[model samples]
Each structure stands twice: as structure tokens, then as C-alpha cells.
Target: MAPATRYASGVSETAASSPLIRRIAHLDMDAFYASCELLRYPQLKGLPVVIGGGRRKEDDLLGKLQAAYPDGDWTEDSFAEKLDRIPVEFFPRIEGYTGRGVITTATYAARQFGIGSAMGLMKAAKLCPQAILLPVDFERYRHFSRSFKSIITDIAPVMQDRGVDEVYIDFTEVPGGQREGGRVLARLIQKSIFDATGLTCSIGVAPNKLIAKMASEFNKPNGISIVHEADLQSLIWPLACRKINGVGPKADEKLKGFGIYTIGELAAREPHWLVEHFGKSYGAWLHEAAWGRDDRPLETESEPVSMSRETTFDRDLHAVRDRAELGAVFTRLCEQVAADLKRKGYEGRTIGIKIRYDNFQAVTRDQSIDGYTHDAQRIRQVAGQCLKRVDLSRRIRLLGVRVGTLVKAGTAPHADKPYIAAEETPYEQADLFFTDD
Candidate 1:
């Protein structure tokens, strides 16, 4: 048997291993939405930018500024410098927000003030009064998401789409994967993405997905961490139990009641004890996860379950008093969702609608149709019926539409065909994805 060795960060040492030692990597885009916004407004690179809240009249402040100074010696190079001269009040801030909107995501700079995703805009306002607040732009984010994923799959063929901003990659078979315990390949993928999108991501390499997911966040905003099985006690045991991807708040609370505050504490419990406490299957999984043992493979091809579009209004709109505006917004949301499905080459059988009232109460309704479709008109008709099911008497602060139960477009010759397939890029090939025609 080979002596166990471990790798930390990028360096590797001899470590004990079983018959099978695989290399898995997890990559997470840092502040993805905020970073996408920065690509458009590079001037706000280091600023406390928050992407959340409803739309506001002042949301177009940057546009107004650009138009007002169009002929006034405005140039690309001096854009950031000029932004410094503008008054802070010109930008929309979370401070004093009275809407029922929630923060979709906040930049790390804004996170210092304790504001993060799912926080109420009004509550976040009290923490970072001057943070620049921007509305969510799903269409733009989706473009970047596709671009980055395409770049990754070209370099590493086996990848699992975790979400828009994160992915789990199987590095055991990729070139240079076993070299330096996958760090070399990880760096290649990271640099490739940055070159393609001008965005930074964090990568973590380990023996399996369970540990790789946790290690990815060890160093963030353009950093990488590598771990080996032998170092699990030192590298992973000390972390909080909630750090594990599957451990939610409820599980954490339940674990806490049994005096388990960290992964080590959970690991110390016997499997049978954990099973008795957390049920059989989950308890067994908990034991396996606590020991950093996971055999799940990368899912190379997984169709999306749903796609949706939503927006928060600057002010609440009544259903009866502002029926026309509400109806138009609803129709637009449905059309946007339909467009997303079409663009992604997916068709869904379920249509749904979401609404958040001014009083902070939210409701959703969905109906499944006989067949899958991506037609905007059909989506709007079905979504309109969903809207009728919800009580519209209350003033709504946010509106959304969704389509789920997705399947690949039947017009395709193969089920594995992507809407936008990855292509080989030559050294001289220019990246015009984000450039204006």
C-alpha cells in the first residue's frame, strides 16, 4: 500500500490512499452578479456595489451622467477617475429603502457591513448607507454564465453545472490533473475563464466533491486551495458543520442540540447514534460526509429544471388601480421567461407566477399544461391564468414568471446538443462576445 500524502493549496506531499484516489475540483465565480455589473461599469471595480432591491428612478443616474458629459472630454481611460468626481448622492444607495424588496446579492466590499443575499433592502440600508445599489439583470448574467461554462468545458470536458456561477469538475482524467494534485489544471481553467470573461473565480481541488466544495471557499476572489485525504483531520474537521453544502440551518440547529458544533464533533458521533438522531439514510450520509468520503461522479449532462424572470418595482402597484401597468409588467415577465427557455433550447410544461405584496407577504402559483412549449404568447396566457389564482387585492412590490419541468427542444437531432456549443479557440481568435458590434 502507498503511504498517505496530502496536498494543501497547490503543493502536494505523499499521503495514504485507498485503491481509488480521484481528483475533483470546484470552481465558484466571485461576486458573480456584481462582477458582471462591473464589466459594464468598470469604474465601480473597488466600490461597495450591491445588486439588489427594486428598480428606482435614480437607477439611470449613470446613464444621465454619461449623457450630460458626452462632449465634455469624456473618454474610456478616464472613466473611473471621472466617477470619483461625481457626487455620492447621485448613486442609488440601500440607505432609507422602504420597499419590500430583498437583496439578490452584495459585493464583498458591501459584505463587510453584514449585508448579504436574502437580506431585506430596508435592513441592509441601515448597515451600508452609501453602498451603490443596482437592480438584478438576469439576461446579462445568463450570457456571462454561458460564456464561462463554455470556456471551462473546452478545457475540462467533464463538468457538473451546479448553478449559474459555480461548477464541479472532474479533473482525474484531464491533462495535468494528477500533476501537483490538479493545481496546474485548475490554474489553467481559472486563467482561461479570466481571459475569456475578465472575471475572477476561486478553485478547490480535493479527492472528492464533498471536500472540494468546502475547500473552494478557503481562499476566495482569485485563489485556489488543494487538499488530500490524509489532511482531512487538520484541514476540514475544525470547520463549522454548516460549511458542508448539504448542511442547512435546520440541520445545523438539530446538530447543535446534540452538542455537535463542528465537523469534528459530528465525526466523533457513532454512525448508529447519528442514524438514530437524524434518520437512517441522512444519518449515514452525514457520517460519510463528516469523514470526507464521497463517491458521487460529475454529471456531464443535466438539463435545467426551470427558468424564470422577475422584477421588483420602485413602488407598490395596486391590482385594480394600476391594472394596466401590472398587466404589462406581467406580460413582459412571461415573454422574458419564454425567451430564456427558447434561447437555452428548452421547453417546459409548467407555467407559474410569483408576487410579493407591499406588506412583505409572498405567494406563488403554478399550473402544468398537457405539453411543453416555449412560445411567449402561450407562456403569457398560462401565466395570466396563474395570476388569477392568487389574491391580487393587495399592492404588489414584485412580480415574476417561471417555467419548469423542462426538457430539451425536440427539434434537435441529439439530446446532448447545447444551444451554444463550445468551440476551439485559436491564439489569434479575438473575444468579441462582450464587445459591441
Candidate 2:
């Protein structure tokens, strides 16, 4: 009798027998919003630059700097050289700028002082008092986001966008995917992006998305890590439970009660025991995650479900006193949403607005239209209506506009013939019936 073929457990028999291995690359921008800001305001390059705050105050600071140096001679490298010439007071004051705005993103230098995204202005100030704080520039960031994604699609057609800052690329069809040359291809992509945009990113190459995401974060700020299936035990097992995608604070606390601190511990538990403790579906997902088994495909062709633009205030502004200024900002957001949709070859049927209050209470309102459209004027009108529904009694820290239910640009074609006869009759029968003697 012939011996049975030994297959890797959990993988499909067909897949195990096949010679091809699916290669996925997860590429994430290094401090995306903050990096883009540095490109425009070169003076912010080496310093700790925080992006997110009130528009007026940010603009005022930008105006002051522009007046002081109107010739645009500040190259990214020259910023540190001329640092002494610029006065300490020339830097924007972090104290009492606007309403209670939080940090959207902080540069590597600011992060060293224990400041990061979503940290309150008060806390961030305590960490890095002299860090250059700048308001978020959504338009500039969006432009760069589009540029990077477009460049990636040009190089690798099978790219799955994971938001403004990251993407999952399918490199299986690229040349030399199965060999050590895969690293070369990844390097080419990284260099291309840097050469084109002067921005840095980190990438991870793995057989699947689950492993790729974790590997990408292994190194930061212009780094790459490659993970092979054979090295899963050494590379993945030691990670903490919270490192897994779906393990939030609640799940982490629950896992801690079970003495499961690492992926290895979670993997050691029997599937039945995990199911009994964590319920059915989530338990199964947890088991698979522990084993690093995610089969989610890289989605290259789907339209975005939503397109949004948001800005964090430098200081929280009162809803009543800032109503007129906020209204103008909201209008600008709608226009940006429309432009984004048009550029991406999509139109949306739903328009919405998001407001985050001083206390961090977020409220949203949306309106669906009769048909999909990408007109900025139409979006603004509908979004303006949605804004009226939200309570404006409290101070708002952030405002955003979003369009959803996207569809491709072109309309569906209508067939000249009826479908009833075509479906009911066989091809040969229909051909005979339609033919003339």
C-alpha cells in the first residue's frame, strides 16, 4: 500500500500539497499625520511636533513663523541648524491655546517624553512642555495618504487599504515571492515610497495577515520584519495577550483572571475549555488567533464604506460662542469629503457629522439620500442638516464629516433583451428558437 502524505495540521490538504505560499505585506506609515505636518513646516522636523488642536491658534502661530521667515528657506535639515536664531517664544504656547483638545499624534521625540495620541493637552504638556504643538492638517495629510496609496497600487496592484496610515499588500504575484528575493521586493517598495514622498514607513512580510500585522509593529520608524511559518513559535508565542488584535481591555482583564498572560499560554488551553470559559464564537476566534491562523483575504477591489475628515481643537471651544467658526469648519470638511470621493472613484449615499464634546462624549447624525452623489455642494447641504440635530449645549473638542455607502463611479449597464426567457431556456434551445430558417 502507498503511504499517506503528511500535511501541516490546520491547513487545507490542497493548500499543503500546493507549492505556492500566500505572501502578504503589511506597511504602515511612521507617525503619519505628524510626518506630513513636518513636510510643510520643515522647522518642526527634529523637534517634538504634535498635530491636533484649534485652527485659529494654530494658524496664528503659523502666521508668526511665516512673517519671521517669509522666504521658505527652512529645509528639514536646516531647521535644527537655525534653531538658536528662532526665539523660544516663537514656538506656539501649549498652555491655554483653545478648548480641551487632545493630541491626535506626536512625533518620536515627543513620544520619548511619554506623550502619545489621545493624551489630553494637560498631561502631554506635563510630559513635553516645550514640544512644538501644531493643529492637525487634514487636507495635507489626506493628499499624502492618497499619494502613498496610489504609488503602492502602481507598484503592487493587489493592495488592501487599512485606513489613512496602513495597507496590506498581496505580493504573491510579484516576481521572486517564494525565495529570499521577497525581502528585496519589500525594500524596493519602501525605498520607492521614501524617494517619492520623503516619508518613512515600516513593513512586515508574512504568509498571512494576522502574522503580518504583528510583525510590522516589531520594528518602528523605517523598519521591516519578515516572519516564516517555521518561526511562529519563537516569534509569536512570547507576545502579551493584549498584542492580539481583538483583545481589548475587557478581554485582557478576563484573560488575566485565567492566568493567560501570553499567546503560548492561550494556545496551551484546550479549545473546549476556552469555549466553556469565553463562550462559543469568541472562544473559537481566540484559539485560532493564539495559533496565528487568520485566513482573511487581502481585499484589493472593494470600495470604501466610509470617507471622513476630522480635526482636533487646540483648546476646546464653547458650542455657543464658537458656532459661527465651527459652521465654516464643517463646510470645509464636507468639501474635503466630496473631493476625496471624487478622487477615489466613488460616490456615497449617506452623509454624516461627528462631534466630540469636551467630556469626550461623541455624537453622530447621518442622513441617507435618494441616490448616491459625490457633489461637494450636495454633501454640504445634507451635512449641514445633520449638524442641526446634535446637541450644541456643551463645548466641542472635535468635528468631523463623513460620507458612507460608497459605490463605483459608473452606472450599471442594462441588457437590451429580457432576462426571463434567457434564464429559462437552454443556450442551444434559445439559439435555435432565435435563428431564422
Clashes of each: 7, 8
TM-score of 1: 0.61
lDDT of 2 at 38: 74
lDDT of 1 by residue, 141-232 (tens): 99999999999989887789999999998787678888888899999999999998999999999987889999999999799999988878
Which candidate leads the pack in lDDT?
1
Q: Given candidate 2, what's the lDDT at residue 360? A: 47
Candidate 1 steric clashes: 7
Give the TM-score comparing model 2 with the true structure, all chains together.
0.62
Query: Which 10 consecutive positions of candidate 1 have the poorest summed lDDT?
Result: 1-10
Q: Which pairs clash in model 2?
A: 53-313, 53-314, 54-313, 54-314, 98-315, 99-315, 99-316, 100-316
